[model samples]
Target: MTLPVDLETDAARLRAIMAEDLAVRGVLDDPAWRAAVEAVPRHRFAPGFYLPGEERDGLGLTVWQPVTAALDPGRWLAAAYSDTTLITQFDGDEPDWEHPAERHGGAPTSSSTLPSLVVRMWADADVREGHTVLEIGTGTGYSTALACERLGSAGVTSVDVDPYRLERAASSLHGCGYAPTLAVADGVYGYWPEAPFDRIVAACSFRAVPPALVAQTRPGGKILLTLSGWLYGYARVLLTVSGDGTAEGCLLGGTVSFMSARTHAAPAFGNPAHWAAELPGEARDARHGPERITAATEEAFHLRFLVQSAVPGAQLATVGDVVHLVDVVSGSAATLTPDCEGGWRVREGGPVRLWESVERVVDVYEAAGRPGSESFTLSVHHGGQHLRHPRVPCLPLPSPEGRPGRSRTASGRTGHSSSQLARE
Candidate 1:
């Protein structure tokens, strides 16, 4: 295929814009990263992608518009360099046609993560010359290309579970004039042949850090990944592997949403136990104080992350004003209903009161001062992982004086006004 001169010019222009955006956001301070961002032609890798659209049906599925260079070259080039995640594969399948009249709707199984986020992650990983980096989930090879540019092709090894993705990424990397070692293997196992990697970064989120990844990393090496689960909450963590294979690290300040590791795609929220559990004999009505406490946490992302972290395998769902808590492993279920007068009614079923557990944890989080994920530390041991906070710290709340659209000061410690919480 012959290259179009105008397309190359447009791609360069867009790349510059993306670099500026990232720099303004304070994520692209590294000159080498900026140079790589400008040098690589992103459009070559993402020849076609899906633009997530509205839900076409009531099943909560989103309609995705497929953008191809042939169909609309201008739009395609624009999307290629835009600072947003581009869906590369849907429902684990690639689009069959170059251009289709109708749109498709399904979950995104692969994507080119937003350029800014990718660069931010690279910065967080602290990739440097001579560092042997192993990247998990090389979806479209865009990030892989960046790593190769910064660390040289021989310094990076990229792996993915999908054979098709590996083949496509290998082709893309080659076209861009760089060929990093690409492998088709389960990322959870962490490419054992390339053991003792100096740095490991995962594009996919994990319910817990894979033991194999910890084992493969050199002692004092950095391992960056997101800890996410069924509830869809996330905490970016950077752990330092110990000589014994145990890693301890705290959550990064902000939350990042990434696809769950293929091997750890949590069980369905309706895990059979929720249906088989028996109801408690009598339901208890939570008092006003507890009601307010529970309601306050409903819209707080940090609090939700903390709750999900403490109660592994716990899932939460909300309908109208009521929130449901369930634990499939223990066959426990609980529901909270608001009485519209500052109090909530609680119902318990199964072997345990899941809502009570959630409530107690919420209290502990509150007592700790509602600290964000940054305040919590995770210790991954042999059997399981443990999340702990040294002191009860309050999460940085939205500023009370600030309006809905206004930004706050450096210290992010303002609580949202009562009205804002209610509206949410």
Candidate 2:
């Protein structure tokens, strides 16, 4: 099939778009980042591609279009340069370029995180010239390329759990005339063959910072990552490795979802249809009761997050007026009854009550004045302990002057202010 645009022209156009977009957004002003953006050709990274408007049943459709490799250079370039996610692995496996049908079923396992998020994380890492860096989740090798542009190819080492992805990314990087030490290994272990890294960035999110990553960095080196938590949103954090290997840094911005490192990937919950059939009609109805809050633009995303978090292994479907939350962990199914009025009810499971959990999250959101991702704060302890709040100090509160006052931090830490955290 003939594509509408020439590859070189598309590549040039992509560079122009990215430069302009980042310039307008204030991300391209950093000369290092700007250089990296200019040097990487997104089309070379995504060999098989599809245009953005193409539709397929699931997430698989986006990754398997080799023809797109020639036709839609802009889509590939946009995906490459923009701060939006490009799905790389679906359900823990690399997409089979030979068979698109296999792409369905599992959730997204890896991606090149949005360009903006990567830039923010790089800024948080505070990487300097000649810094040795280790990047987790090499995906399409786009971010690795950026790191190479900043730190030099010799100073970077990139790793991923899937050997196929690593191999493919190695080729992509090589085609671009840049090469870093690429390895097929579990990212959770941190690549120690080249240890004492000055900076470490995880392209994937994790419930906790792997102790190995902290231990592998030089004292005072920065480790930037997305801290995963039960809350719907995640926090981009910057932690400094101490001589003792313990790390501490404050949250940098809002949240993003990334495939958990292989060791942390959530176990499969099994077939959804079977679980739906097993749910009791009453429990399902109660969970789907009318939503009490007004319908707002942000409600859908938050609602999806809460439902997925509350009902692990469940699939959520919104069909026009009704929302369906289905869980099929054991070939047994339960569903939440949809309330056209915006309420929820669970029609399955014993007294565990999935709907109640969702309602609780909704109540929290309402109490917080329906703040979107920006209004939340997340903090994590060294051992993976975490807390979330709609406001900050995250604990005991005091006035701006540091005097003990009636208002406490939402999470209650004294002498802390919520103003320190920013949203991405």
Candidate 3:
């Protein structure tokens, strides 16, 4: 894809403007990072991408239209450098660059993460001179290029599960004059050939910090990631690997997410639960309102996060005045619906009583003064990682900021960036 000279001139100005915009927004403050942001021509990484169109199909899913640099250089360049995530592939693979599509509708599987987030994460990771880094989820290689610019190509190793994306990312990186070690491998298993990295930065989301990642990193190394669940809560945490094979960290505030790692992606379960038969559930008095756990309030994500920890795979939804919880992996489902007496009634089904556990956790959380993520601490071990709040019970666990007409910042592409459910 040959870009015109005018676009090249425009790209430099546009890149500088973007760097300044991030600086004003306070995401890009480091001089080296600023230089990397300014030096890289972003448009070269994403020659085409998908935009969600207004049209909807019979299933009520929005239609996605494709825009190419070849077809529309102005729109392509503006989008690439803008603080918007560009969807590059659909349903693991599509928008075939060779025979690119006119329009399509499916899940977005890969993307070029927006710039502010790209820099924010790198800054947060504390990437410094001579640090050997391993980046999971290569995506469009835009972030890879930035890392290479900050720390030369030989010091970086980036891997992705999608060969299609890696092929394109490799081309873009090499074309941009970067030769970072790129590989096709599952992110959960961090590429073993390059073990003992100083920093393991997972651009993708994982249900838990892969224990193998802990084993591969040198003692005192850091692992940066986002944890996602079936309920779609994404919490970013950074852990310092210890010499004793343990790690500890805390949740970083503000919402940000990424597509679930293909190895850890949520399964498709019809009716929201894995059930043998839809049996009428046992009814009981519901002491708590559904809004306590599922509202858009700041503490709501915390409450939902607690529920996810206790119940594991439970997915939450609502119908009329009723709030539903379903665990496709467990066949447990519960519905909290309003009754005539200005109170809610709980109906639960399946092998395990789902709502009972949720209610209990809410009681524990509310008693602890409804502490949000600030109180949350993430600790990892040879067995696995645990995200726990001091006052809450432990189970297991799981990105940021809004932009105009945008709601997420992807670290790299796996499912959809930041773990909030797109439909929710």
TM values, all candidates: 0.84, 0.69, 0.87
Q: Which digits, one per residue and each the tens of the lDDT, describe model 2 over residues 216-265?
A: 99988988887542222344667787786566666554435566666654
Please list the Cα RMSD from the true structure of every candidate, rounded to 1 decimal place: 10.2, 9.3, 8.4
List candidate 3 stretches off by more than 4 Å.
54-59, 98-105, 272-277, 317-323, 338-344, 398-424
- Give the Cα lDDT of each candidate: 0.72, 0.59, 0.77
For candidate 3, the clash count comes to: 13
Best by TM-score: 3
Q: Is candidate 1 or candidate 3 better by TM-score?
A: 3
Give the per-residue lDDT of model 1 (tens digit) for 308-397: 543444566766676666665544567776777767787776544555655666676666676666767777766346666677422221
The candidate scoring highest on lDDT is 3
Model 3, span 1-424: residue lDDT tens: 4667888889999999999999999888899999999999888888888878777877667777777876777887888889999998888765766556655467778998888888888888888999999999999999999999999999999999988889989999998899999999988889889898999888888777787787788888888888776677778888898999888998887778788898777666665333423647557897777777667876777667656665666677765565777766545578777889888887777555677777777787778788778678887765444666666656444311110011222433222112221110
Sort by TM-score, best first: what order? Answer: 3, 1, 2
**How many backbone overlaps does candidate 1 show?**
12
Q: Candidate 2 lDDT (Cα, whole model)? A: 0.59
Stretches of model 2 off by over 4 angstroms after superposition:
1-17, 52-66, 69-114, 228-235, 243-245, 252-255, 276-334, 339-342, 361-384, 388-424
